[model samples]
Target: MPLATSLAIFQSCKIIGVPKSTRCAILRDMAKVRKAERRPPLNKTHKLKRQDWAKKYLKTDFSKVLWTDEMRVSLDGPDGWARGWIGKGQGAPVRLRRQQDGGGVLVWAGIIKDELVGPFQVEDGVELNSQSYCQFLEDTFFKQWYRKKSASFQKNMIFMQDNAPTHASKYSTAWLARKGIKEEKLMTWPPCSPDLNPIENLWSIIKCEIYKEGKQYTSLNSVWEAVVANVGFKKLVETLDKRYDFPSRNHFSRVCLPALYDECRQGVLKDLANVKYFATTTDLWSSQTMEPNMSLTVHFIDADFNMETRCLQTSYFPEDHTGQNIAAGLRQAIAAWNLDEGKLICMTTDNARNVTLAAQLNGWMRLQCFGHRLHLAIGKLDMIYGCNY
Candidate 1:
């Protein structure tokens, strides 16, 4: 019989003021009562098998492979529990609210071998779907690691990533295959296991450096600046493998030594071509003075050759309505650099009527800004009458 039912019967019988010897007889009988069904024994063996496998996997080449993953950093306070003491009698202490001075921005980034790829802006409401994943893989990740001449340093290397839905999708898998990335080359770490990746250690180091400078940030720009300035590639690499120390007398000494040796081998070979020069892109914004302003920046590379970026000259609508004024700034910059108009490549800009007309007149190729294209796509979706594509 269940313990609760037996205890209830005992209590009811006691209320009747039964004799002590009779009550003792009932209690003794209740002690021998048992349930009709039996349960399976606890599976200690299965747990032990899993642990053994984990230990073996940790000692293999899987651990030597560099793992990469993305994390989002918010300008707002962290999610989940607040740390502090609670009084003995207090009815669930109130969470201390942290005041945030500025709004937040979404940062999308991937890391491998103590190297970070980006903290690219993923504007609010933009979903991180397969398409975005592909874009990031092609436009940012592969571009930064393989396309540039400087990144020639990464030849014949393997990259390890998680089995995220997008990463495992058919399209992404095919893309990787086309790019000469091998599935077998990728090290498969156990699912739901983050403790093994050293990048997590790097993140802690990044946060420490950010706070060490004693700077307070209130805006998204300030937060981005602080994060960028603090977490460079060198600092991330310095913290890797710092937690492990193997004794020479250990049975597993040789097994662990190979992983450490591999790291040293890669560290000694540096790519002197400088990858930083090709990873930047240019952006041009309008000024309040009704005059166009242009800034040159690097974006990405292709086939180890740096792909130059060109921003369209901003067009201003004045009472004069003359093309000469708009073209003057661009012409001056080109002449100063001694560049010929025939050598000009792709031009990216907003779909201003004047700018389109100007590009057509100059015989230069123009691509509408991708941000503008996304905005237009969203607008079109809202106006889809019925089955229009």
Candidate 2:
């Protein structure tokens, strides 16, 4: 029984609670007993075995080996996020939401000696069936990587890939045989494994490099631009050059396994500044206000003053319908991106009080749209002349 229960019974016996002498006696007796249990320790052990299989496989010479894989490129926002704080008060810790915009992506790739062959964007709705995979091999990967090599290299080349259903299917195997690709040349991939492929590392490096630049894309055009700008053939070749000599048998355990684990840790510490930064013209559209939808565009100029339109964002007017409210929305968007107030050099918009006021607040030199200006100019000339011309 609990000491509190015993104390309660003792107190019930008396009108003014238990006597001091009785309370002291109960406390003294309780102090003599002990409670609580200890738990036993757990033991764990891990062992690794490096195989000689890769050396035996390479005994036939590396000229016979070709590596292949696929990579997915998103047409919308890439599946990633920026780490930041959120919530309020004690015990209300911030959470990291994995940012992803629902959009289609393409996947196709291959590898050769210290070289990456194809990151060909797959056509939309094309499933990764045996026929599609074979088409990529014959048309894209072969034309891009194999045909360019010496005839001797082609005769001896062996393609390697994972046991993806498409790669292992009977139709794909038959296609390879018809193309003079030997079965022995296909590297035997272990089940449930990704560590054996170095292309995995290449993909990670590309994503990390892309994110490091602070770039975001909501449309397919922007996504393609970002992907093209980041992963050129030259960079892929360079990556392969550095890591190709790594042991094949222990490829996953030795290189990819450790690299992948490290990438996870790096991801936790990565930030928005890691994404590539670009400037572009942005047009804002909204229907809920009196102020006509405002459109403002900003351009980024390098040190050489070579200008390119980059960052684009939309601003909507709220119920206030005043110039102040419109200006406030634009300011909030600018502040969210952490752009320098003084560096914003230009603004282009239709002639409107809210638009002009917003530009003035930001100290930007305003340029009226020439097309709109031309229309107004032509209208005034016709009115003054009083002619149908």
Candidate 3:
């Protein structure tokens, strides 16, 4: 329970004590504060479905499988990040929120042969149904890309999709069969199990790239542009052919990954050169091994007036987390990216004293993240009332 709630309980029972002393007593009892992990609530049926699906695909080859999904990208952001700076006891920061979340674009995409496939965006207000989904398949994969593939490749290909009504509808199933994609070629995916989909991981990575540094779009077009630009599709087809075995773990980790990172780093640096002013966010984290790390992300509007965000650095910080040390680390990140300190507008971060002091030490204004503040407030309610919200 929160201290206030616990105190209220004790007061009801005619007990009183200092808040600090009460906290100390709780600590002596081996109680400690910890953050809760968020996860989807899965019932027994969902669990059994996942187990069956795992067993069915345990030894299945995924190289020839094409994974597809439809994702909606909002103008504001993926999670509609609400942020502001306000003093204690202030009401929630106000923003002119729009109806239906300012609209968004729904795009359908897939990955096959280790290459990204069609990313066809649906027309505004167009709800996807069986007929529309079949048309989407015909216009995208069947009419163009799939027809170009070799017959042998097509024979061995498998299509994977979630159990959405449009995906599993009788009309869509019949359409796939008519197009030579029979039952055996369709991968049976588990219900409510997106985490098992590799393409879902790709979507997560793409979204992170699109909305780096808390970047938000004012218009749907800008949001789509950001999505298309930062898709970061990997060029894996060349090395993933049947004649060639997959790259050895060491070769990929040590050589290919580093080369890819360097290429991407140069591109980001080139783009940042033209940016006049940008805001940054920083945070410290620790790995399972307790190795400390700090990250810096930059956000700015580009020449096209599209909000853009990119991670500048995530450096291992073995040094003490003093304000001066953190400031020095941030400076190193800024210097690494060839960023002008004068062009930095501010740093957004949680209400950590060291991080706050670090912003001050770097002569940067600090914007407290309202999301974190809201989380803390909600956490108090959870502790006091035993409410999960």
Candidate 4:
């Protein structure tokens, strides 16, 4: 039963002391919340086919194999879900499902030998028919990886994809034949078995990363960017696994960290080049360990007039929190980014003497944050009112 029902029962018995949290705790000790597992529908024939395919590939070498698939990401949250919390052993809530027509993008990608193939964004409104699928294969495979490998390598390599209509079409088969991809080299995938495909796991990881923390994209372009970023990060992790046997924490900090930072810094600088003016905000804070840190964030209106914000840097400041040192640290950050001082607008910060002095030292106008002022005002009111409010 739902927690509300239990709460109502307790209320009717005049057990007001048992709050919602207590009820939830009592429920948790007896039951668990679990989402239903999703699986493709499979009949007896499909199950037999899967078993046969599994037996056939039990001893096959998968090191030289490539897996490919296309996935669609929706602007709406992941696969539509509707449910009311119920106790364990209760009948599952019926899912409210609907056909996804628009507001999503389809992307085709592959993974082979610790390397990522094309995260090719399929054109909107275009169906993935036989001819287009063949074209995609030709472009991503033959034109790139296949062309670069030796005859022996190509001969031993296997191409694997799901049994979608386009994959089994006559045109696609003829195209593969022309490319000298024999039946022995083309893996015959079983129906209703996505668990066997490693690329599906990769896709799941990418999706989880993309939609982590309930992230929602406002634009398809942002979705594409996220896809690319997550895919690229996956490739990087794969490369790290392949090259480094056992890299230490210091190794990553000394080597990989700088490379990633430089790449991001360059990208930010390229975007900033077009902007004539931008505002910045800085704040000083301490970690749980009380280690001092300062962060700077840049805000600018892009070409589309959309207000874009970027965290320029968060730097450790072990030095004294004097105005001169703060000013020097800000100057150092500005110099590192190669930002033009003349293009700088006003700086925004809380009413901190050191921060204001730092702005003065940098010869920039400062804007006091109204949010901080309000917070201070509220604190004073609470002090004056005691428990009355």
Candidate 5:
């Protein structure tokens, strides 16, 4: 939440060492104030459910929880984004971007691997009831999709679904029970949170890949074909493998991250501009695909004699990572930072032949990076101790 205005904050509070304009600019630029519109608020029970969903199940594998969601596949257009600047209570003209009963197809699907489960389409003009949903599970799911699984496979699996009226109804529960699915076995889902559901993103990815191949869709069959062919399921899984969560892009993307990055970068540069001398280190590596890359960093002692380090660049190495090419990239990055060579100390990199040659070519005093040397020393020690053991 933001205060009414910067002036109000300044007037009501003590003026510390911070500047008025700086604080006001931060509020206006970084602090986005969204009006809490009328929406269903979560109760304590829902909060606890969300908390439970967050906790790791030690005895259970994640594959047991079959994440699923529903999506509307529309041919009319990709959902468009709208943004604006406005004052309080000021009205603006708007036009309806979506049609109620035309030009969209409702589909349900699940994803746990590169393979997609059935993208079953809900019939037109048919409001899905508990019986129909259960029928879908028995027919499309059991017969067409998952019936091929081994008994052990199905035995280990636990179904997850949103707490829609149909999902929780007697008909649905009875169907699940007949299939030996326990009621308490279902994974808890927090309401009003699409971010928690990764299957939703899988749908978007398929859609985007479909359109990227061809903008015009003659039939919904072509759309499904694109979904089946082009979507990179493994890549999407690999992306989310390490990270827990990202902040809402709509909030942070517009200004917050970029602004913070720029501020820190400028601060580093300002410090470097004053430092009399500094050293740089380089590292080079290749991807699994054999694409070469280089990473460079600068280190220095600031005015207070505090050891400071900052990564200058990490990007593709040109053509090949030969001595000449590496030197070209190294010089370019250093020049971009406007680092002076006159008062420079030395350049540090692993004792790679090409890298050392590149340093010598540039007339730079080359030193072995202490970090790389220590890493090599540790590797040698491990090898020696392992043989004895």
Candidate 6:
């Protein structure tokens, strides 16, 4: 309270012997003891949220975060204070700057542990409201970062943005919900805490470099040039890798699907070569196009005594499924696979009379498929249960 108000209150109470001067001194001492008020300090909730995030993802690969943010660059020059030293008599340099507003342009960007992408300049006079920002991300991140890498690389990745008003707005959250990103995945940020965000520091370094060496930013095009020119991508990648221990692109490729595919292919070929004989099962089924499709699948035991199955063929079987026609089709498929008729142990199909007759004509031991028999058995059981009940 003010000294005059304190005095008036004290005098009105009429219970104190202390005079106005004494009251003034007391108020002065209290003011001296009190701390200065600061604006918009971090609260306990934000602190606890940050602590929880750290605990949950302390060892997380930061490389997966597709870090995105908007930066405003003033055409006039960089904002904020700058200091320097001078000789006793020489006048110091005066760079009077204002906060970014009208003359500046808003730019969007996406970054990761392995890459520092974009100075993706936003259009002039455009505001990235909730819907607009989501569209921007869909355009940039999906088309650029995601398409550049394999799906395996994106398994651990997520889109990260600060909790700006638009980013946490209803439209943006709804869009993210539609994409199956829930809770912390989208709103995983605390208020006014830029130090926790590495992109903020990245932007700081970029801004400093753009205005260094007495450079002048005259237009949006020049500002874009300065931003892109100053970013030493080679060094940036190296620094991020060194700091976060991220893998190089080549090393990353080695651990992805292509390598797994090659290994699986080799293993399968080696197993097939060792098997002396195999039985095959064939079936004619209607495809999504409502046309008849025939599939031939093989079954055999490996050298390890483990049973394995592999598909040999799936083709458009001829419409004529008569005994002679089906026999010819089965013979052609068996011959195409280089299986000796003498070594062919057996063949199985549904209990269709024409298929059985075809097998007998082809001179292969014919058997009914156990799966088709079991399906028929289940239908009989349903009738038996209905009659008994």
User: What would the C-alpha RMSD of candidate 1 be, to one decimal place?
Assistant: 15.9
The residue-by-residue lDDT of candidate 5 on 94-129, one tens digit each, is 534445322656678876544456667777656778
Clashing pairs in 5: none
- What's the lDDT of the predicted structure labeled candidate 4? 0.80
**Every model's TM-score:** 0.42, 0.43, 0.51, 0.49, 0.44, 0.47
Model 3 clashing residue pairs (backbone): 1-383, 2-383, 2-384
Ranking by lDDT: 3, 4, 6, 5, 2, 1
Best by TM-score: 3
What value does the lDDT take at residue 104 in candidate 1?
Answer: 52
Tens digits of per-residue lDDT for model 3 on 218-258?
A: 78777876665563433232333335343454786699889
lDDT scores in order: 0.53, 0.59, 0.80, 0.80, 0.71, 0.71
lDDT tens readout by residue for model 6, 1-389? 33346556677878477877777787676654343464446789878887877887677777677777888877655533244457899986755454462277677776776677665777777788888787876787667656687767655566677888998888888897776566645437767666677777777777777666445555676676666556543356557555644344566457755787677756656666767888889887887668887788888987888889977768897568788988888788877666666777999889998888888898889788788998888889889886431
Model 6 spans with C-alpha error above 4 angstroms: 1-40, 87-102, 180-187, 231-234, 237-389
**How big is the RMSD of model 2?**
20.5
The 10-residue segment with the lowest total lDDT in model 5: 240-249
Q: Taking the tens digit of each residue's C-alpha lDDT, what string does model 1 give over 19-61? A: 6667668778647555456433326774565476477555454
Off by over 4 Å in 2: 1-64, 75-80, 84-100, 213-215, 231-389
Query: Which has the higher lDDT value, candidate number 1 or candidate number 2?
Result: 2
Error of 4 at 55 (Å): 2.0
Candidate no. 1 TM-score: 0.42
lDDT of 4 by residue, 111-142 (tens): 77776777778877778899988887777767
Error of 6 at 84 (Å): 2.4
Range of the 10 consecutive residues with the lowest summed lDDT in candidate 3:
233-242
